[model samples]
Target: MRDVLRIEDLVLKFRGYTGVTEVLHGISLNIRAGERVALVGESGSGKSVTARIVLGQLQELRSAQVQGGLYFEEQDLNRLSRRQWHALRGTHMSMIFQDPTSSLNPVFTIGVQFTEVLRRRDPKLSKEAAAKRAGELLNSVSIHDHARVLNAYPFQLSGGMNQRVAIAMALANHPSLLIADEPGTALDVTVQAQTLHLMHDLVERTGTAVLFISHNLGVVREFADRIYVIYRGRIVEQGPTQAVFENPRHAYTRALMAAVPRITGGGVPEIQDMDGAFFDPLEVHGEDRP
Candidate 1:
């Protein structure tokens, strides 16, 4: 498959009174057409920042300095004007943020927001037609009571329901790429699993390449075709999902895998990045890569 999104040596920095604080240190990754790729790291590891930059969000901030090439379909994202970037967002790319509450408008009814999203792809679509299409989209994400959902505000619904609504809106246009940031992290384990499954099937059938950002190794194992292990601000290791799971090369990757709580209730091992040995780049290649 051809690469739908590619980041080459991306570096992001925020200018502050204290000085420039570098958050991402020349990180690079990509997602091919219809491929699912994961970027895994603990909090403050710059996973979400990478996703934001890819979506052209960072370019909107005056204080943010984004270096390196960000390409979507061989077009340089850096070269795009703000209006041009806005035009690409909803139809060609969309993002489901970490929290449904944050992504969904608090004041607007879900139906209204859903219609607005649908309009991004079809400007001339009537509200009545958009409403009907929204209902079908909601149903695709397992939200059966589409009428109630459309009429209700984000705060009125349960976390899982709101998340389903968020997913429904994100995939409404069948965008070429989706950036899902810790999707379902706010819901209960069972609900999270169900949400993930629904999202997985929808994206697969629509052929939408996904850049899944999360700290959950177990979820990444099941959801991603390839995995990129990040530590601090750098990509420490990357390989095919099973290859990384079977033999995590970097100390951080091994420690991260060992830290996952087992279903059998085994002891969670202490992380041993041991003297910061694994902070350097650990590249995996050949048969192990996707």
Candidate 2:
């Protein structure tokens, strides 16, 4: 299968009053058509920055300096103009944010917001048609009462309900690629599992390639076809999901895997620094940050 998304040595830097801060050193990964890939890392591991770069959101920041190749469907995303980014964002690729309630517009009803999403692929679609399509999309996410859910505002629904709505909207246009940034992270374990199941089934049936960014190993094990372990903005290891799970080569990957609680009831393992570099807590002057 052809690759839907490819990142080659992606490096991102932000210019500040102090100096330049480069976040991503040189990270590369790809998602083939209909393949589910996960970028696994802890917070500030440059995962979200990579996602924003793929979406071209960071390009809007005047202080942000981006280097290296980011390709979508074999097209050079780095060369895309702002107008081009706008054109490609929703129609060719879509994203589910970390928080459904916050990512959604509290001001607008779900119907209106969902209509906006659906209209991306069909500019001439009528409100009635959009509503019908939205109902169908909601149904796919297992929200049967589409009428009520559509009319309800984002704040009006529970976290799980809003997450379902978010998933429905992200997949509304049936884009070739989906970037799910830890969707349903705020929901309870059972609800998150159900939502993940729904998302997995939807993508599988729709044949949409997914770039799932998450730090949850258990979730990645269940959802991703492949896994990429990232540490401090660098991709240390990547392979088929099962292979990586069975034998993690990188120290960070091993630490992450070992940190997961097991049914055998051994407490969490001691997670050591991947590089074993000691950071003096008392030292106010630290090394260069990512």
Candidate 3:
């Protein structure tokens, strides 16, 4: 499988009045064609930031300092102009955000919003054609009543329903890459699982590579072929999901695995603080030294 996305020595920092805060520390990873890759960690682990960089969203911030290569199909994403990214974002690569409400406009009917998205790639597409295509995309995501969904406002739908609609819109054009950033975090566990499964099925059918970012190890384990464990902005472990889970090499990876609760066992065990022991640069392979 050829690599569709690659990041080498990626670093991100933000400048503030106090000083510069480094968020991502020389992160390196890749996603092969039609492969499912997961970036997992606790909240504030820079997973979201990495996703944003991949989607070319961080280029807008003047205070942000980004270094290293971000390649999509051997094209340097960091070098693309904003206009170029605008052209590529929806048609060639799309993103599903954590909050559906934030992604969907509340004032417009879903039909109107979806139509606009369709016309973004094809300016001459008629309203009727766009609606028909939108309905088909919605149906692909298992929303049977596409008519009701298209006519309804985002606020009128439940969180899960809105999320499904979001997924439909993101996959509407069959983008080669899908950047899903904590997409199921807002929904309940059952709904989240269902939504993730639906995404997996759709991606499999379309052969779209997925870059999934989440804090939930359980979801990552279930959805991703390969898992990258990141802590404090640096990747600590990367390999096949089963290998990392069965034989974790990093202390942080072991801690994260141990944190997952067992269904048929005693209460959740307290994770011992190793006095910042796992954060040592010497213990991890992907860390950049000063």
* Maximum-lDDT candidate: 2
Candidate 3 regions with alpha-carbon error over 4 angstroms: 264-290
Q: What is the lDDT of residue 182 in candidate 2?
A: 90
lDDT to native, each model: 0.87, 0.88, 0.87
Q: Rank the models by TM-score, top first.
A: 2, 1, 3
Structural similarity to truth (TM-score) of each candidate: 0.92, 0.92, 0.91
Over 208-282, each residue of candidate 3 has an lDDT whose tens digit, in order, gives: 999999877888888999999898999988999889888988778776766555788554333334565334322
lDDT of 2 by residue, 69-127 (tens): 98899999878899999988788899999889999999999999988988888999999
* lDDT: worst 10-residue window of model 3: 280-289
Ranking by lDDT: 2, 1, 3
Residue 148, model 1: lDDT of 93
Whole-model lDDT, candidate 3?
A: 0.87
For model 2, what is the alpha-carbon lDDT of residue 49? 90
Worst 10 residues of 2 by lDDT: 281-290
Per-prediction RMSD in angstroms? 5.7, 4.2, 5.2
Candidate scoring better on lDDT of 1 and 3: 1
Question: What does candidate 1's lDDT look like per residue over 1-290, in tens digits?
Answer: 68999999999999999999999999988899999999998888898889888888887899999999889988999899999999999889999988888789999999899989999989999999999999999999988998999999999999999888888889999999999999988899998999999999999899999999998887999999999988879999999999999988778887666555567964444444657543222121111111
The positional error of residue 170 in candidate 2, measured at the CA in angstroms, is: 0.5
